[model samples]
Target: MSNFSSDGFDLDAISTQDNSDVIYEVGGGATVIQNEEPAMKEVEPSFNTSEHDQCEEFKKQGNEQFKIGNYLEAFDLYTEAIEACPSKFTGEEILRLKDEFDEKQRSEALQRSRLSEERRRKKEDEKKNGVSSSQPPESSKPQPFKTFELSQEDKNDKLAVYYCNRAATLQHMEKYNDALKDCDVSALLNPKYTKAFVRRSAAHERLEDTEAALKDAKAALELDPRNATIRKTVARLEKIEAERLEKLKEETMGKLKDLGNSLLGNFGLSLDNFQAVQDPKTGSYNIAFNQNK
Candidate 1:
């Protein structure tokens, strides 16, 4: 052996030596130390937190605010929720599109039925004339009928609930017309929701639409017959509607009277020139023109 120092060898310096190109023989194969960087993992997006979750959280916060009668705060939170998850608030648009699609489908179905009937009539006529039917030359293949499908997002009940809640808040804030619009959206989204109907009725009442209020109240009653509040609302709305009709009738009669007076004034005559004598037995009135001043 060569002469070796009694002190420890310089192990730290040897260990710290750069081994970029160092190779070691192991099992008759060279194992090289690579200076390459370590492979990085491809990070996948986390599905744990999403817009839907944010929307739900906002909705919960809104509900809490609503319960405490902080309608403005509730409205803001609900609005934020709608912004976060627009799909949750697409009830009105979904209903409108569905109605449009249904109308189109009905129209197409009727058209097809009429076309088939016309073809059958033509075939009968041709048979009577002893003429064989000629097949029309086909052009490009017929395009497939387009199908309308409502995505899960569009049909969400939570959207209707949010609309209904917002409508209630609007009603509290005395924004009757806006409340009515939101109520309409909520009703369109979930027709069977009694609370929506009730809220809409209240909105209609505030807007002096007694007829509409009555209608909505009656609808709510129909949905929940045992709900005394709705029954009372129906009664109140009916009374209001009656009063409204009476007031309208009086206003119409007043207008007509004014018009008649104006026309009579133009003719150098007036309602004062007319006299009526009522006969109680006959329940009739005999009119006469007064020549006296």
Candidate 2:
């Protein structure tokens, strides 16, 4: 066996051994050691733990400020968190992180299934005894195995949340357009995040873009069907959208009538002289000329 050293294996010991040809150092500062097993390449960590922690601290401070209705202060802290967050990985680094994330997710799924099975067994035992246990149900939430080590995917999630929080702050500040921009970033970072959709819907509604607001509200409602607030928002937006469309139709028809009256003034005719009748089956309108009118 070869003994390990700071630089590498002890070359002096290898020279005395019968297997001298098995190991040798190459020139030009490049050392190649031949062993019974293949060497493993070290993967560099994708995120800086210190930076991730700092980001989390800032986010927590922001949340506290938000709870007290200090929206401007909260926005500033959330911005700091976003600035301090881990930069995204690219190329091979990102691919390796993704692989690790997928593996962890599979492990978490397996753990969740096992926990569910245990809960089911406990329920069956309680049923057999004809006695309900006072104990609370086991939480089905799947926790990642390690706490200290922050994965690249986790950092990404935190960054997304920071953006969403800032968006909420901006909404409170009455900066609807700026809020919409941050909401866009949050949604892009985490497409399944329901709050991003909700925030964006509110921004659109504030800007009087009822159609866009309704679309985003519906998206949020789709993601969280059981959320009473989101369901109510969807219903409210739908009503507002219908009323808005009716108002827009009335305005457009009024404009068209005004223009028609202008052109007909030279011919002693007005829009009132012609009546538009809608065919219910075809949903088409027919204009009837009535000189008596």
Candidate 3:
């Protein structure tokens, strides 16, 4: 009675089909999803707490080795610990300790790198100049010069190396003042640093301070009497000094000659035959020459 099919209702007729897409109606309209979406696979995160424990365990082992004076063994263990957990073991307290470890490691690395670099540079320099760059004057800037903050623990040996090498760099720079300071440090850090003293001597020589250079060279010779290089340096410096003295004498004599000629008309004398005599005993000069004033 409510507007239904007045005569009859054809339910079978409304059961027709169309080849269009399937859409659902919700709030009076429908939207369609065309492509078939792929399904997602599940993945579990990798977090093995046991590995962290192992890392700690290895670090503890390294500490034990360090306590027992087994530095080499301690080094290996510490390396393993770092490899295991670089992130887990990061913190303020651990950072301080890690810095110590890092310093030690850096010290070792620097020694190796410096020596290898020196060899390479030396070979190249020798090839180019046909002489050993090592024989350069004390102020010669060192090849493979690099710097790093070093550990404070008995790092004298390590610092000695850097200071000595850097002194060479300073020498090459002609920064004699700074180079001498570095040499002092190197020598003080390691009294057995004979080369340091020898190098210091060379820098002094370059600065024309022969007295200090001779003293340093002597000290170096005392430490390592057999070093041919140091011996040669001493010989070269001695020769230089001798030549300097001789040249100085010649210069003084030339000045005296000029002075003697300049006295030609200074004193009015009847004849040009006047003579000046220097007494060998008194080092006093008695002059008799034509004077103008």
Q: By the lDDT metric, which is better: model 1 or model 3?
A: 1
Q: Model 2 segments beyond 4 Å from truth? A: 1-45, 89-155, 276-287
Q: Which model is ahead, 2 or 3, in terms of lDDT?
A: 2
Candidate 2's TM-score: 0.58
The 10 consecutive residues of candidate 3 with the worst lDDT sum are 3-12
Off by over 4 Å in 1: 1-56, 80-154, 272-293
lDDT of 2 by residue, 182-261 (tens): 77667655666676787688778878898998888888878877777667777887898899889999999999989999
Q: Write the per-residue lDDT of candidate 3 for residues 232-272, one digit (tens) a residue.
A: 66676677777888999999988876676577437533333
Single out the weakest 10-residue window by summed lDDT for candidate 2: 23-32
Highest lDDT model number: 2
Those runs of model 3 whose alpha carbons end farther than 4 Å from true positions after fitting are 1-158, 172-174, 190-192, 208-214, 260-265, 268-293
Q: Clashes per prediction?
A: 0, 0, 15
What TM-score do all the candidates reach, one by one? 0.54, 0.58, 0.36
Clashing pairs in 1: none
What's the distance in Å from true for residue 32, model 3? 82
What lDDT does each candidate get? 0.63, 0.67, 0.53
